[model samples]
Target: MPAHIGRPVINLGAHRVDTDALIEHIRTTYSDPDEHPRMGVWERIIRNAGVTQRYWTRPLAEATATTGVARRAETAFGDALDLAETAARRALDDAGLDPGDIDGIITSHTTSWTVPNLDVHLVERLGLRPTVARMPLTTLACAGGAHALVRALYFAQARPGARILVVVAETLSTIYHQAETTPQSMIYRALFGDSAGAVIVTGVTDENADGLGPGLLADDPFELVLPGSRDRYWGTIDDDGLHFESTRAAARAAADSLPYLTDWIGNRAVEWVVAHPGGPRIIDDVVAGVGLDPEKHGRHSHASLAENGNLGGAAVLDVLRRMHDDPPVSGDPGVLAAFGPGFNLAAIYGCWA
Candidate 1:
């Protein structure tokens, strides 16, 4: 049975910050003349990051304040769990299903260091039955959203009549550490936002489903890892908090590994695409690598980045939500893909229903 993805719901942070203002604030924080040299470069990078505004779980002053890992984890987890619950409720309501209807739950959360993950917390908070199956992805990073949905598809296919709830929440603002001055860290300061997104997946196509809202009929889920590409993207933790690190190869990793995606999409006229808003480079590569028009097919992905910054695992979900504004014709073939720290790629092909 083909899995159908219902409309996704997204929740962003309370604190919204414009890119320009954020750049200026960052400069003021690092007042030393020597720091100015590096801050100067980051300012240019921020200007070109293709982001207008982003949300943070905490206030700018508090978020940018250096802190211990234990405190960061306590706050980040509280924020993520709160955000995920809201998104999950909205998603269930959108699907016209009660919490009891979901038989399986899949969640991806890497921004916070939490012992009991989102899946367990959601089941308890949402009043789901204890027997409900759970799958939590803690290390997928930015790719976690699409990664969770791909797993949801598998669950729906494996169990007939199963309805899976997919949720991803990130408090990316917690990674803003004043101590880290690397270029990659600087770009990250401009590149990420805090968000949570959720959607319901059921094992039924348009032909079989009765009251499902406008969404995609999912199929052909795929995942890949470039051999010896571990260095492309990785994360580390320290006294200040989490840090996102990347190398030059990370810039080209998407383009390098997209051939496998294009291969699987062979001979199919993929009419639309929802690529991860990792940054401008990843979006551009998805356009060229997949042979799609940036103006038409890639516009929503760009819009997500411009408006929300990169919402980590929530990016693909946010992009999918935006597609409804300029929806494709029913049955139009499309692809959704996300890349994260492993230089890992998770993709799912579908058609508007």
Candidate 2:
């Protein structure tokens, strides 16, 4: 009795900003005496990020405005809701189902802080039944999307014939702060983008459910959290907005987790790999860590990163969507992997039906 995950539907922000333009904008915005000297360094980092373009919920100019955090949070709140609704609706439609069919909802968001969470609002916006079970995750960050699916698998297994909707949305652009002159902030501002993605997971009694979706096998998923690695990547709330704290060691930490990853994967043949596009180095680490053939399985994750930049938890779903659109040979086994703030690595093995 495996749960099936529907094809994911992704919705990127309205504006697509060229990477070169973004670098130039960053230079102009931080042209103060104290920050002027580091413009060239920032430029180098931006180019090395391996992203040519990324979408933003609002125009770059508006996003980089000197507005206070209150205003930024306010704007992000509204935009997140709109994107969440769009992706969720599209995902439901893609599964050949309606809102009423969804028995549970799972949402993952890290870009903004809100009391009621996106799940509550999404249920209303999409006209779902009020009694639908809801679980909203705010802590997973980049790993949230894959983790959402893992959680959905658990829910589906617990209640047979359950239909679950998973939505992951991030407005990283809203967290860009011109006041922060640190290299971590600069890299985050240049590399991150805004996007939303949704998927439907249906629990079925039969393992060979016809065209139900990609089956998340009954096998247990894998997770690894490095001890005391919390400070390697995180965000802090200040008057301006959320400030990112990322260290060079973060990439090394990702690579270091390879042994644990290998142990969890065991002897499974991973024909396809869905990895979170943390950055060039992180992707490289994952490829090496998971022992994947770069020529064969690496393109999907790299393509997702190049096109959408890093959408945080929404990234893995984007990659999964691409695989669904083109699809691999039926019954090909695949693996989904992502890393987030807890210095956590989460992976799930599945097969296309």
Candidate 3:
């Protein structure tokens, strides 16, 4: 092994739309008085979220439209390839490594499908080594990104001197409900957007290793099981679009658990919190649960909320990218957390180096 364990994320790149354009797009496309009221509820919620921009895989119509099976299939397949390739290459470039140097690939996307999956497609398009190992995660929702990263770390631990490329491309926009108005459905619609991110991790490190930084803080992974919360947020294909349900109780459970986890990790206030930017209410509830100044975490939370809405598995990374780009200081500590299908929360603490 060269030097370090889990390499620190050194650079991040993303593409997104500003808040004003996103709000206008949502109002013009999805919300209607009959189906959705002009009470300015969503607008007010988003504005309070503190996000100024977000990104997606397609226009809002494509998300909730009733299209022929053949057309939907075609769109999903093609878009999956485009998203995977774009994100993978960007991460490779940021790490200053040629794609061929990626000894392994871990791809994560929950909202769509591809025949060979993005790993094989990326191997072919980017001309990676023919023997590059492939690991693809299609489920697990928002937790997929961190899961993939941790898996990469595990692989490195198994065999020293290996390099793994981890990529997450969850297109939440591809799964949408335009006409649903229940609290669950409304929360789902209000939260999700589409985006992708990738990171390069080397098993071995060096003082001069490109795109590599400090070691990862250690922590055991835990999943909080909230019984009967299975249906709190579930997605299914329908004529109107992909339908989602986000229950009030589920949101409360996620909020309630934050404090316990925070305290377990050794303190109440962290230098940074990378909580998933699910929606205004979810963030608000989590803020109250953690009892920290929302103003501190509010900017990244609201910024990710406003800009990308919620990018499912990619949401936490979107926030992390913001922190990586404009970090607070060299020794600041952070907690990266997100809630997912198990109605569970996942967290890892880190130091900025």
Candidate 4:
């Protein structure tokens, strides 16, 4: 039996920051007398980041304040919980199921560190059964959303009637630092937003599962961790908070992983390509690498990035939501892919129902 993915719901932070404004803010906060020579270069890079606007839980002023890690973590934890709960409720509603019906829950997040992880918090707030199975995932970074779904699919398959809730939330804005002058850190401020996304997955035999949504075929779900590519994209924690390490190689990693993805996809007719919009460059690279017709399928990924910035693991789900809103013809096969730290590539094959 296959696992079906119900409608996905997304919740973004309250404040939307324009890219130009963000660039100016970065210039004021991160610019140094010694780095004056490179300020022009930094401006060019920020303008080309492919984000026109991004949403945040707090305004730029609040985020850039001289706050300690404890304060930032507190803000992140609260914001994450609010967004995660909201997205989860919306997803459950779309699936036409109740919280009590959820037999298992899987959560993926990386923007903050906390005890009692999100799954535990959600189970309590959502009124799910205490006995419900729970899995909380971290460290997958931007790939966490798709990876969570992949894991949920497996759970659904094992427990025939299980209805699983998969939630991914990231409050990346909380990690922004004025002290970190690295180019990657500066770009991160302009490229990422706070957002949460949730979806419900159920086995074919699950109650009220008469094909309510797209089916995740049990045949092929693929994951690849590129050898020695860890440095392409990663994060480090210190007294200042989480600092991101990103190289130009991060954008090209998707193209590099394409051969492996193609091999995993085999001869399947992939009519729609739902890819994580890592950035404009990454999106273009993946389209070219996968042989996709830009006019036909490229907009799906671009729209997400242009509108939502990078929501980390929540990004793939945002793209999925867009695809669902304007669906393809029934029986059309599709591929979903996302890349994150570990230079990992996670993908799943599905068909429109």
Residue lDDT tens for model 1, 118-231: 888999999998999999999998999999989999998888668999999999999888877788887898989999999988888445587666788887799998778899
Count of steric clashes across candidates, in order: 0, 0, 10, 0
Give the total clashing residue pairs for model 2. 0
- The Cα error of candidate 4 at residue 311, in Å, is 0.3
What are the RMSD figures for all models against the true structure?
1.2, 1.7, 4.2, 1.8
lDDT of each residue in 21-130, candidate 4, tens digit only: 88788667655788777778778877787788999999989987768777888788889899999999998887788899999999998888899889999999999999
* Number of the top-ranking candidate, with TM-score as the measure: 1
- List the candidates ranked by lDDT, beginning with the highest: 1, 4, 2, 3
Residue 328 in candidate 2, Cα distance off native in Å: 2.5
Q: Over all chains combined, what TM-score does candidate 4 have?
A: 0.95
Q: Estimate each model's TM-score.
A: 0.97, 0.95, 0.80, 0.95
Return the clash pairs for model 2, or none.
none
Best by lDDT: 1
lDDT by residue (tens digit), candidate 3, 1-353: 33222322211123445556556755776555663575377666545545565455565544457674456655655665676678777777766789778788887776664567767777889889999999987776787766776677677657666778877766665554445445455345556666666777666545334545644332333345556668666656654444555566665767667666767677534666667777776676665555556767657766777756777777777777776656657666656677777676666655555
Score each candidate by Cα lDDT: 0.89, 0.83, 0.63, 0.84
Model 3 local distance difference test score: 0.63
Candidate 1: what lDDT?
0.89
**How many clashing residue pairs, candidate 4?**
0
Positional deviation of residue 283's Cα in model 3 after best superposition, in angstroms: 3.3
Model 3, stretches more than 4 Å misplaced? 1-53, 60-64, 68-70, 204-211, 214-222, 239-241, 263-269, 284-291
